[model samples]
Target: MTFPELVVFDLDFTLWDCGGTWCDCLRPPFLKKEGQFFDSDGRHLTLYSDVLAILDDVDDLGLPMALASRTERPDWARELLKLFGIQDRFPYQEIYPGSKVKHLKKISDLSRVPLDKMLFFDDEHRNLADLRPYGVRCQHVASGMSEELFSEGLELFA
Candidate 1:
């Protein structure tokens, strides 16, 4: 296996704390609960060390990353990215509110990057299964997501 030149991250449960639901991170203001991601000054907050570390490793490798989420609001997604100070890390971040299966295909096609050259880090198995036909590898980020898995993934990208 070889490392890919690009990696795609699923935003909701994968990278951000969304109250245990998909799209909870970037839900529209009208749909979000009070203080969903509010910080001390009432600004929205992102995820934990997961976000920083992921970006750091990707940056060290000089690899391209894509934020692939079912988030409906593009503006909110951009805001969250900026809040994390990682807005410059990603060259292509897309918000796909509809079926992720379709979006994954579209992203790969639009980027002109082969599916085999991309690794998807998502918590959902169904979404990963849907991309199997495209030959894209998926890493399930459960509570056990660890450095071993991370290194193992690097093997695929290599």
Candidate 2:
């Protein structure tokens, strides 16, 4: 299967096991103790077990990645990515509290990849529905991103 020019991901449940909403108090320089991520407020976050492998596969495919998160705590999200040592993987991040469409528009503008050339993954069905109208291939990651879903996306993009 061919790959999309850019692959965009949602931060919350799609990537990590944080609550529906993250703690606003989370600060920079987050620590990864044991197998989980922790913020200054002691809020714990854990990436789903499949995330690393899927990310690695995407990296091997040499696809540019971006983040489209409707998270109010963008700083916390950025810090968490840094702590996980994957911040550099996504050079185009639109982390803010707004519609996913806005995030995708920014990413599309920056990457110069047309909306149809973008593939998005998010846990929320609403996000997928919203993006579909723009011709972006959207995948619903109900239980975090998995190898199967990633493969399916690749095939669809192809």
Candidate 3:
């Protein structure tokens, strides 16, 4: 398998489902219940079943990873990531409301990885489309992330 210098992911529906909506839509002060995370509104927050394995796959490949979320509440999303115990996985995080092009530019500048050598995944097609001109291999996640999709993204990058 070939590898990109950086593998970027979007939070929201791409990585986790925040009670059937975006993370920003979920009420904050997130809490844990019965080993599961839930928003104050009792909206369940969880990484998709294949998330850990996909992350592990990237780690096993020794590829650097990042997060690019356009959530209105970066703090809330971060809290959930912390609660989910996966925040440390992404050393580079670009969580804010803006074009993913800016996010990828920032990531490229920070990591010194060229845009062409990067792979990005998100639930929204527009997010990926915006990065097309920059040459980043973009994968639109029709649903939550999965090992199969991740493999396909890597293959596309390769």
lDDT of 1 by residue, 68-138 (tens): 77776667666666655677776777685766667666777777887778888877788788777778878
User: How does each model score on TM-score?
Assistant: 0.75, 0.87, 0.97
Candidate with the greatest lDDT versus the true structure: 3
lDDT of 3 by residue, 35-60 (tens): 99888899888899999999999999
Model 3 regions more than 4 Å off = none
Tell me the lDDT of candidate 3: 0.91
Note the residue pairs that clash in candidate 1.
Answer: 2-156, 2-157, 2-158, 3-156, 3-157, 3-158, 4-157
- How many clashing residue pairs appear in each of the predictions shown? 7, 0, 0
Candidate 2 local Cα displacement, residue 81, angstroms: 1.0
What TM-score does candidate 2 reach?
Answer: 0.87
lDDT of 3 at 8: 98
User: Which parts of model 1 are misplaced by more than 4 Å?
Assistant: 22-44, 144-148
Local error of candidate 1 at 31, Å? 16
Q: How do the candidates rank by TM-score, highest first?
A: 3, 2, 1
- The candidate 1 region of ten consecutive residues with least summed lDDT is 24-33
